[model samples]
Target chain A: MTIEIIIQAIISGLLMGFIYALIAAGLSLIFGLMGIVNFAHGEHLMLSMFSSFWLWTLLGLDPIISIPITMLILAISGILTHYLLIRYILKAKMIVQICATFGLSVFLRSLAQFLWTPDFRNVGNPLLEGRLEIAGIFIGQPQFYASLVCLLSFLLLYLFVNKSETGLALQATAQDRKAAETLGINSNKMFALGWALGLSCVSIAGTMMSNFFFIFPDVGVHFALFAFVAVALGGFGSIIGCLIAGIIIGLVESLGGLLIDPSYKLLYVFLIYLIVVIYRPQGLFGR
Target chain B: MNNNLQKAKLEPVWHTNKFIFALIFFLVTLFFFFPFINPSNFQLHLMIMIFMYAVMAQSWNVIAGFSGQISLGHVIFFGIGGYTSSFFYVEYGITPWIGIFIGILFSSLVAIAIGIPMLRLTGHYFAIATLLIGFSFQIIFQRWDLIGAASGLWIPLNWDNPWLTLQFHESKIPYYYIFLIFFLLSYFSIWIIYRSKIGFKLRAIRDDPQAASSLGIPVAKYKIIAFVISAIIMSPMGSLFAQYILVIEPERMFDIEISIIVLLIAVMGGVGNVWGPLIGTIILIPLSEYTRIFFGGTGGSVDLIIYGILIMLICIFRPSGLISFFPKKILERKKFL
Candidate 1:
């Protein structure tokens, strides 16, 4: 392969990976702390994408400008999800949680299909509105903006976790819920916060993705699958792991496409998933 | 402590002996008389489809329901079976009767290959591993042009040779009976497994894997066995599905929706029991038929919405399934001692 093509692929892959990281961060946090495998995570992302799409189409708001509104709406949805569905089952078996989330996923996916009719929807006014030629390689505006947005979101998340009191409380809850409760932190509130924050990441991803790709009902399923791969590759429950894993997966996808048909790229990437699953079940960066 | 609460909440039930016998007799009669009652080609076609899915669901239940290894990608076995048998039958004029055995062998091989690596993964990890396998199969099956690639192979029209097992006489009776046999076989196989010691071990593992392992149960071996058995049962479904439909395509067999349908059936019927799938099929098959009738060829995804809502409601309140709603005595007695 030409060095220029390789460089271009790497850059695009890195950008794609960053967006993946944003999509996955929330899932990792929820899984890490509450042990609730939110199978509907992809649905939430899809929901936000639709929200952003309509916002741009109807009101002429930019995707970035629509983020706060999406976050507010998603935050409420997350809290309601926690209270209405997840809270009662907190003490139930893990299988219950999995089943519940699976049901929720189906519900959300169906709802999307019902409303959107399986047609692909896109955001108005391209996020970047142009492409850049760098070192004899072309880069799209959306890809660069999406990557930068993803990076900034991660930094903000790191700061939220490391600097903020609520973030510390969340970490404590993740480490040990009962212990966190013993320290006078309300674990339930923390869970609510975690859900909101996790979904907020999805909202960010939704906005960014709607700018680049068409939004379909099953869009979340694809992203959620990749997010899980990212989570596994990065190590479950690790933000930094998700970041690195996303990039690795992007490279795998991009490079695999170069080697073979793009449609068959999942074959090679899933092989990596199988190898990692067998050899390092804890993930590459899982502690 | 938690066990005590669970036990209290889930009081077991026992069915009357006469009721159990009557139900079995009714099912047998229903299977035998189904073709006579509705000799129309469409009804038979729907019945065959239901029986095919019933087998698929029953097979999945062996691992996901009974053993508590929820594989969202159980379609791999179905796909393998469909591809193997269809390829052989279409390419070599080999009857699906012979092709079924070959499908079984390949599916079993795939089970062992996947099981050894995946036996260690529990819960979400296990689910993802199976999902990956499903994706891998789709890619492989789609790329392999020898098997007809994405467009898939079309069986040559051969209505003249009935003994060859490749003939189509335009009557659905043969298919209906074949699928009835498939259902009966799957149901009987599950029943046999339910009564066996391995079934007990599976139940124990399903309830608590670590404790089962601590009790000296070969958790991995039993899991592999359960998965392999499940695969064996599903392989024939594929063969029958292809033979009846007169077509075999990768997407038709290996789609994520296929896996989801299995989950829906197993979940709707109730997981971890023999009768769970039957209950699921009884409810879902009719609903599916109705949806198609109402939607009429091309609407939107109204059926998916209805199906999704039904699944969601069941999961929300009755995650144990319709079986949980049975009278206490009946449920306990039928659950297998």
Candidate 2:
């Protein structure tokens, strides 16, 4: 491959990586706060994409314009999920917790199929609908805008987790639930907030990608698999680690597809995941 | 000394209970043959499916339930078995009965190879790694043209000689009886293992690996052994599945859904018990079949929805599984009597 082509692949991969980071951030946050791996995390993303698709098709609202509504819906659903299912299994065995979330994932996917008919739908005549050329490199406008949104959301979440009082409370609860409760932080509320914030990040990603990618009930499976690898590669509870790992996965996928057959793209991503898990299970940025 | 005296007094009662249990089991086995006496093809097909799933679930229970290693990627063994047997039969004209043994050996070896490295990780890491391995295997099989790639391999239908090919021309009875034997063999082996010294060590590892190791238990060795045995038992069902369906594809054979179904069946019936998967198969296969037959747009959606709800409820309210309820109730009734 030419240097220019390599650079192009790198840029695209980086952009896709940002979106992947957004998708994985919620999963990492949930694991960090509650120590529960939300297998339904991908289903939440699928739901948000469907919401965006529906809003665009029915009201002629641009996907960009429906971001807040989609986020609000998903955030509420996340909170409901916490209260309805997750809270009950907080003290349960590890396998029980895992199966509960897995069951929820199955329920959500089938429910989506029942409601939406499993047809792949994409937003038509999206607001950002062209390609941009920057000094001999080409980029899709939708992808660029999606990456921009990803960066902004990541920064906002980082600031929220690191700079705010509520964020501090969430972290305290995650560190030691009983200690946080003793300090009158209401750990339950903090957990609910974690779910809200985590799912909102997924919502933004789903909305942004709705413009370019096909939306379907099972659309989240591949992305969810990638996000799991990213979360693991980044370490279980580290947000920055997830972002970096997500980008790395994206780059590997794009470069691997370019260098080798596209069919082996997932092979490269999984190889990196296995290597990281074996050598550095704590992740790149994890403490 | 008093406890030993009481145990000796109760020995005859325990022996009689054992005899009764065995008699009941024999009767149940006889009952299964009733369907064969005057079988409809559809009913026989469903029976085969139930038996196939029961074998798969029982194998899964060995690792996940007995050893407490929650592997979510067991479909890889199933796929390996299907692929191996089909390849042997298609290429060398080997009988599926013989081919299945080779498939079992192949799957067992792969399980040991994968288990050695994977068993090093604990809990969720092990689960996720196995899942990724399964996905990678599916992707590789999909891309490899030598194994038929995405189009998959098909076992040609030869009606001339049925027994040699392990194919019956018009009688689903043969398939049912074959799978019934598979189920019995799987259950009997697990039953023996559950009562053995190795089974005690496996349960010890499951309950507390650190304590087990402190007690001189070979924790890793036993776990790998359980995993390999589970994989070996799982492969034959895959082989039977291929012969029954007359085709095998990467997507269908290595699908994550198959893994989830097996897991659910084991969990729903009662994990760690020999009868758990059998009970689970009995309850689930019929429910799923009826739901699919009656409610028809894509068929699987409604059944999956119900299954999902049932699983969540079971996990939350009855984590010990439905079978636990029965034994307790039976014990209570006996006490009252």
- Report per-candidate DockQ: 0.53, 0.74
Candidate 1: which stretches are off by over 4 Å?
B1-18, B166-169, B334-337
TM-score, per-candidate, Cα-based? 0.94, 0.96
For lDDT, the strongest prediction is 2
lDDT of 1 at B123: 80
Instruction: Please give the lDDT score for candidate 1.
Output: 0.82
DockQ of predicted candidate 2: 0.74
lDDT of 2: 0.88
How far residue B307's Cα lies from its native spot in candidate 1, in Å, is: 2.4
**How many clashing pairs does model 2 include?**
0
**Per-residue lDDT for A217-242 in model 1, tens only?**
98888788888888887788998988
Candidate 2 residues lying further than 4 Å off, grouped into runs, are B1-16, B19-27, B329-337
lDDT of 2 by residue, B68-186 (tens): 98888989999999999999998889999898999999999999999887887877788888888989999999988988999999998899888889888787877887888888888
C-alpha DockQ for predicted model 1: 0.53
Q: What is the TM-score of each candidate's chain B when compared with the real chain B?
A: 0.92, 0.92
Query: Candidate 2: TM-score?
Result: 0.96
